[model samples]
Target: MKLTQIATATALFFTAQLAFADNPETQTQPAPAVEFLLPSVEVVASPPSTPLFSITDPKAPRQPLPASDGADYLKTVPGFAAIRSGGTNGDPVLRGMSGSRLSLVANGAPIEGACPARMDAPSSYIAPESYDKVVVVKGPETVLYGPGASAGTVLFERNTPRFTEAGVRASGSLVGGQFGRNDQNVDIAAGTPDVYARVTANKAHEGDYRDGNGNTVPSAWNKWNTDVALGVTPDADTKLELTAGTGDGNARYAGRGMDGVRFRRDSVGLHFEKQNIGKVLRDIDARVFYNEADHRMDNYTLRETPPGSMPMAADVRRRTVGGRIAATFDLSERVEWVAGADWQVNWLASRSVMGIQNLSDMPWTPSATLSNYGVFSELTWFASDVQQVIAGLRFDRAAATDDRQSISGMMSSMPNPTFDEQRTRVLPSGFVRYEQNLRALPLTWYAGIGHTERFPDYWELFSPNSGPAGSVNAFAGIQPEKTTQLDIGAHYRGGAVDAWVSAYAGYVNDFILFTYNTSMGKATSQATNVNAEIFGGEFGATWKPDGHWRVGVSSAYAWGRNADSGAPLPQIPPLVTRFTVDYTLGAWSAGALWRVVSSQHRYALNQGNVVGYDFGPSGGFGVVSLHAQYDINKRTQLTVGVDNLLNKAYSEHLNLAGNAGFGFPANTPVMEPGRTAWARLSFRM
Candidate 1:
């Protein structure tokens, strides 16, 4: 495809307004805070505006009912998919990559899930409506966050509130939807310029939803969260803050043998920032945080025990503590530099019971511990008014230790092969990018290349039953993986049109893959390494014909291969596209969303990440939804919408097979919810 022509064709894409944020006129200005109480149609299909980066407000009202977790909200974006696990807490996949490859952070702190089965994915604990902004950095284009971000990085952030006088401000929303669905959220702040306090809270609940066939799927959930922050502004450019939060929830799943009975989280953090220290030294930022996940899974709590398996329950916990310190330097008028160092430690332990046993009688046992210490530096250079360059380098010492003493098999128990073993690696990562502005065409072009060496994560090391052919176990034999990738893209804005496109290709030297085998009536999961190749991209455009009418369309696709097996990668999403149209006049507005998904024929059954495996090929499908918004005065708003408007029955390409206990045939993909309607009301004070 011709780069210039494609850029012009997608001129009206969802992120057109986002690209305007980088226009010469607004290049130096910080992005304005966005509120969800008043939403725009374009946000439903939003794309990244800058090269490899996209930013959007998390509280925005969207179709398919307001998202139950971060992963649910991300599916609306191009080049992203979610592995459905029931009604909520689906795992997110980007560019065909899942698990540790995607780094996730909240308020500058990392929070990891403790479930080996991934019932509580990192996104599960995230309440999008509680955060101010959601930022995504696709691919391994930068190393400022942490290691193992081969796919990308996602950040959920909150802005500090500064009050000029002693006063109070608050914003909140109430929502109700089909299947007994209901939700409530509120954010409030109070204090003076020198001191301030803020509180954010939310609760959501839903009952089982029926599929198009009028069959009820075992999906239901109830969740709640609350967070508090206290800050001392002291001045305009300097501030210190402390924050803490706790939340817990439970969910039922149709595709799993066990259900998540408890999903608990606890977090605390302290951060300090100082700007404009001097001429050479621009600023300093530092922070420390502690987070923990306590998870419990059982079949009896939310469902009856399967015929073959006895009643069982498992409890797991992971505690993580980390800190980061960074400083910015003004090397020259055209050059800026940032350097930082970070350290994190994670401890994991677990306990379990069988056959109606009391939970309190089970003894806790240590399982594993992992840690990482890293240092990084990044530089941004302004070559001229239309050309720029940016580069970064990072190094980390990653280590893991096994604490288990024995492993239990279907018939007996034996000494653990990797007991008391420790493994460590020194990994390095770096990236460089160049950007140029076409002064005459109102367009910008960018290209970047990056390489990263990743340490095997816990799931890769300890969860598998076996290792490569000659190795005794996964923990003792797995090796670090390496990835090298290149990305390129362009953006264009013309009168009534806006567009953007990004493409990437990469080679993985040691990709960690899993293989499942059944022998002697027992199932075993083996972890192995292989060389692989991957490539994909996303493009879109938007057109605004008049002051009251707008139209837009966008699409994304991804492909990957296992170099060693000569087979298609498992669980890769199929080509997908979305079309949108909206009209607005005075205090009333309306919009329609149309989504099209292609059939996925490729399959690598029993080979995938921990969350899911390929069930089989799926047929293509389409769904349409419509929504309307009303401004009930400046401080209040009302919005209503219906998803699956035509009541079309469908399932996502990336899905989990239904469990027999749910009355679903073995190896069959679970179906999505049927037609649903919802309404939301908002208030600001």
Candidate 2:
């Protein structure tokens, strides 16, 4: 059933029953307590858009079996893709944009990966099911988050539950699948109105998976996490929360020369909120956080070192500290405003050991330090019931310092020109949007324009061996990226049908791009600046034919061009479409999803982002999945699904080529799994 239909029926049903009891003489006895189960949320590879933004429950069951990280889950959304490396932890890309162009925040903090090769992208540290909500804002539609969000902003948050009385609340799920895949998650809370405490934990493990050809690829992983939150509510309008978390994991990579021996995380945070302060001053929100990641990579940790290759190990670590303060104001009946400021600082260090040496005995070396401070304001104006406007402005100061003393190459060593040098930039960003609702028709249309200036990130400035010509290095040579984009969208809602479409076009000046070259069996990376253009659109429609049946379809397409070289941008995904059919009856619900991806021939050889480069061209493929949900009782539910039911062999366009150690030719893309069955059981109290 459509979401609207279900809501309408529920409202009408309660209204009718209440009207009958208006007269005391006709009042009936109270009905027995009963639970009304809502239809289960079906997992679709490509779901329809939700208004100007999208909010999804991270714990909900999703297709492609189970997502291993935040990136895997985001792929189910249109206009989003993952640069695959192995079974999990693919780097996320949106609208042909990747890297730091996308702002990723968890619990109001940003935790950047430490790998120079991007083996552990930021998303790799995120376990989707651990968070309560996943929120996404596409395009440069808002400037309240921070700078450098030309592609978009993603947030993973956990809501602090407030209690009115003493009680216990809990929710959990267990999952199992083929190839020794299994996971467990649990969340529990108990307390009184004055104070409360909550705890969440999860564990997941999977063995090497076989491709459609029954070939085992070097992909396997195991991880676990635990977090706790304590909250104090002194009054009805105030709340203070303290939170801490820790986690660790290890994974075997299929596209790299080494395996991740450890991915350890430590975090602590404090948040405060106060509401209903006065008429003009609405509320205040403030938060502070600290996060650290310690990662290690070694060729012999998870697998034997290849012949003629020396045993080597590298350890890298990153520490980040940040805080945000915001206030909401009601200037007038038709005007509302939000103003905020955020600041963050990060420290990075690394050390390596070779030839059967003790890694811990080596001292860590400090490499880079980065810091940024931003201030922003957003205002909303309601001209009328059918018209609205929103505008936001932001400014940021970014700074970075290099700490290397010397550089070493295969041939010679040179003084590090940028050593002890600091680079800084002042950036400004803003966006304005106008929305109008048709009086006669159930429709809304909106248009927006945004401009953003992005400073070079850690990878762009420090990872590459060389910078643009005629400069000391990337730190001093690369310029900040500037983007100007226009976005337009429309939404329509009628009796039994709802549809929406959104499109974006943008031009980028001084875009940061990376190129790879090989010499004497060693690869060297170079960073450069270029001009580029990008455009994309996503559309979807859903129709409810009857109370128990619904059908929907969604499609997404993206295109890009490198203006300087007159070549197609690398790592652009092909056009894709999804079809879904759903049925609901009482306590049982079923669904079927079919996904199709078109061929991509655009190629910019040896050119791409840090995660991967384009592999000439990839062919189209189709896959179908079936899922069913059953509500065993008010507090218990079970979901079962089969993905790639036909056992078809396929590889995504944005993929990393398999490494030679994995028994595959160098530069050969890895194949996805085939015909996997999975089941999940969830309970709440």
Candidate 3:
């Protein structure tokens, strides 16, 4: 569908909803009072709400001046790290795993990026502040959202608006910080019992940030998004909604040869939900969505062209359409079953121009087309008041077709052996878990085992220049990745203490690995398969000794090795920990956060994923930050904070090397931002 058509339809729907609210029979109600205040800043995310699952409010103010994108916000959660490229749009890594292993879903749809180098990752398109809820399911423990979530699954969702009478509700925020940073957000909803309309929009911008050494990092970005939703509530048990949104952004990357001049996103979706259908069928939910990502990068748009290098630009786009249907059944008094089927189809195309030609004017070339169909069922049995069993099974058929007439080689275009060829795989995934709640103590323990088979993603199949030995290319050589893992965890909640710990160990067969090599002054990457072993864990605790005081601590660690080569895995994050203390009194509160990260000594040189590589050993560092909040009124609040208080210059272990075009030495990791201050004003009515 066209963007204009979607926008026009949304406008009409919103007007209709408002007109319905003007009915003489409709009873107008006063807005409710705000009863609770959100935390000033989230230094460390609260412990998981359940076994391997966490739910967070995405609109809450957070440390480090909030986030510019989804990945930046996930870093506050333990076991989550980001591969930073610049001021924004960092790629998210969970348990040292990247790529398709982590399923990212936004509003019941999967959005894929078109950049072969992954400059615009899936998370880049997600505006976290625009969503009402963020749910994280760690590990391959569930089969509800999608397939191949061996590392984890993250969902960004917007709750359907419901109203008892004719009324309006709104919330918003404004932010300002050093380095020319600023942000604005607004959310508004209006409705009666029969219909509702909601709108959310945000804009964020920043200039180049300085490091501890007082050097500019060549990082800057600007982004904006607007979304609209109209819902019809025929009864208390049913809801039907339609959503539309569009967003665009630009960024200057310090770690790549080109800067992103455009990141255009357009989306449309329809959702249906029903509950309490019958004695056996509890509820049914279904949705269909369309998402498109049109991206462009150039060497001259955001910065000056390198000396003696001609200006160059490339444009690429991916169009995805998907639908899913799921139903929940009360099989017995104690057993509940959920079954679903989903299917998706995506097409990618690109065009490029050199010198003085406009890239957009060039005719597009078809690159690849991919599709998947999956069916899944999950069962939960409540054996007793204190015991439960959960199991799930899923099967997927995935296929990819290469549409390229020829592949690019080191020196020139070459005949492609896999041109116009199709490859397919049938994969299966399943998991089982047992849970026990101690009757005498406020604690719960659980254990589970899961196995998954993942088809090679676009980056692994087409981005590499070469493939395994004796293979034509990555598309023809890379094999499916299979992982089997055991997970165990415990959660304890009592008087003043709340704590949780989770751990996982897994063996991966045919794990995909990338190796970077420089020959004849040209850098090329090869995709290969290897056996790998991985293990990791995260622990956290919070102590509320009294109503006025709160303290928290959390840490995460991950390790991996190539079983075939006996070498450490590339791009694994080092151990990291956080300590937080807060004091609240009346309408004012203050807090402090200290973060420590260990040095990384084990790594495979020049090897990693499509986005980053292991350059060398990295040094450890620590930093501190402080924040305060004041309630301006019942409906307004103000928050202020300073990050990197000590001006510590450090780089994360999972990092991309600084681009030489930005005046940084080859193989040098990009440095993080220095000491900075920021403030945010939020209000609701």
Candidate 4:
């Protein structure tokens, strides 16, 4: 088919689907009771409100992992995917959306890494095991955080301490598992009724991981971190906090060409929250923070470079700093409001020696750097006890300024030059929603529409050597992406028969894309501002008609398409369903999870049926799990779980490229592990 015809067809398909979101009938079905089972070690057994697709909540006591970097702990959350380069630092993705789309916050502050290729993704600097909780809010449902979360927002927070009377409290855990996974974590707090001090530390390491085929993948890593904070609570309504932290780690990769030989990070922050100022204003939660990262790559970190593979390779580095402030107000008993602003700036530098057989010295590429800043706010109004309306708006301006006398790796015609070019962008976003609670039917219904704008991130700009004929490097060349979407859903609970369902559809403009050319042996990608459509829903049910037995089943499906390209976007997973059943008898609960994923058939990059490396159309795989928990007294518990019990060999649609260095046989491919088991012991005093 002609390109125009293909484009026309794609546009028409999306137009019809996106328009369906407003029908309201889409959410008429009853909602099933769907409770998420968080990670065994740090899990919050149950809560008054069920937080879907979330693995952690702030109510639980903080328990740092015995040993780990941030990426290792993210795996505990379902629907989260990561690109593996090494053990300590993995690129994090949620619902297939990656890069700058997802916002990462630590202790309610923002910090980004300095690597051009994302050698130090923000999450990599975090010690997940060291924090108290990890909260993930999916989709663009709320706007209270910073900006550009078209995918979602992830908040890794440290729990706050409150004491009515003078007392000291502490919680700790120890874990020893397969693959040399030994972790020890401790959280301690002590002070007078009005003051408290807290501290956390962690470390971890692993050898190369063997895939299902027993072929080792370059995943070896080593890392450690420490955090100290002081809190003063004059009263329950007001509090002040000051925090400082430092962490560093290194990883070896089999998939990427380079390894992270050095991962050094430093950060400091201050936050204050005041509540109940008057009848009209509720409180102000504000903060200021600074974070920096330095990364190094060399041949000695992973393995000796092969011939013709840029040998004698060594040394590269990057750095970044960010800050923000936010406030909340209670206009009245039924209405609340919020506003905030944030900014980020980063710099890059690299030096390497390359030659034949590690013999000669090649001059290093000149150091390069860029800077960006944005200003962004959000508000909500409650209509009645059973109804609410929420609206939010934000405007952001980002600019990239570079200072250099000469440009490296440019065309010959572009002779010597010394000047500065700066590009500034303006973006505005807004959303509105209405919710209703029908007490007569014991059900709650909500519907909303939102639009968001995302600025181009460093990876999209600095990583690419060239942009389209008329554009600059991705940073200056790509336009800001905007998304207008509608979300509608309902929750219902009817004794013995509970169910739930939520659906959403979106229209996207200026959707970024990446294309790879195997024949040319190079990756060709760009940001194409095109219309797009996305829709999905999750449903589940639970039946416990009588005591001692229970049956439950749940399913989720999401789909996305680029209307202008007539091609399926990368990393969109196929339909998936999960079934669980369990029994409870005399102090013990046992359950099983049976999951099935349909085969993915739509693809574009590699061909009509593409299926490999940063591409799509992956075959399907099934997995099963068995779990049990024992309540050993009110303060202590023991839980054991076995994953992939059948030892099935499988992989997710989104996967990391395996490095050739770490022992992955050239002709053979690597797959995730077949099976794994874990046990958790918890103590609180």
lDDT: which candidate is best? 3
Compared with the true structure, model 1 gives a TM-score of 0.93
Q: Candidate 3 — number of clashing residue pairs?
A: 0
Q: Each model's C-alpha lDDT?
A: 0.86, 0.84, 0.90, 0.62
Q: Which portions of model 1 show Cα errors greater than 4 Å? A: 1-37, 42-45, 518-523
TM-score of each: 0.93, 0.93, 0.95, 0.83
Worst 10 residues of 1 by lDDT: 5-14
* Whole-model lDDT, model 2: 0.84
Pairs that collide, model 3: none
In model 4, where is the ten-residue run with the lowest total lDDT? 42-51
The window of 10 residues in a row where model 3 has the poorest summed lDDT is 1-10
Give the per-residue lDDT digits (tens) of candidate 1, residues 1-685.
2334323423332133335434667444443354434665443556566756889877666776888898998888788899997799999999989999999989999879998878899999999989998899989988889997999999999986677667777777777778878788889998888999999999998889898788899999999999999999988788899999999999999988889989999999999999999999989999999999999999899999988879989999999999999999999999999999999999999999888888767888999999999999999999999999999999999999999999877677799978999999999999999999998997888999999999999889888888888998989888998999999998888888888899999999889988776344334688899999999999988889998888988889999999988998888999999988989987789999889999998778778877787757889999999999877655566778888889888888788778877777667788998898877776565
Clashes of each: 8, 0, 0, 15
> Tens-digit lDDT track for model 4 on 616-677?
45788788877776655344445566667887777655555454555454323346655656
The C-alpha stretches of model 3 lying farther than 4 A from their native spots are: 1-30, 519-521
Q: What global local distance difference test value does model 1 have?
A: 0.86
Residue 185 of model 3 has an lDDT of 88
Instruction: Assess candidate 4 and give its lDDT.
Output: 0.62
Prediction 4 TM-score vs. true: 0.83
Residue pair clashes in candidate 1? 10-499, 11-498, 11-499, 12-498, 12-541, 12-542, 13-541, 13-542
Residue-level lDDT for 673 in candidate 1: 89
Off by over 4 Å in 4: 1-55, 58-79, 84-88, 307-320, 353-376, 403-419, 494-498, 520-529, 540-552, 606-613, 662-669
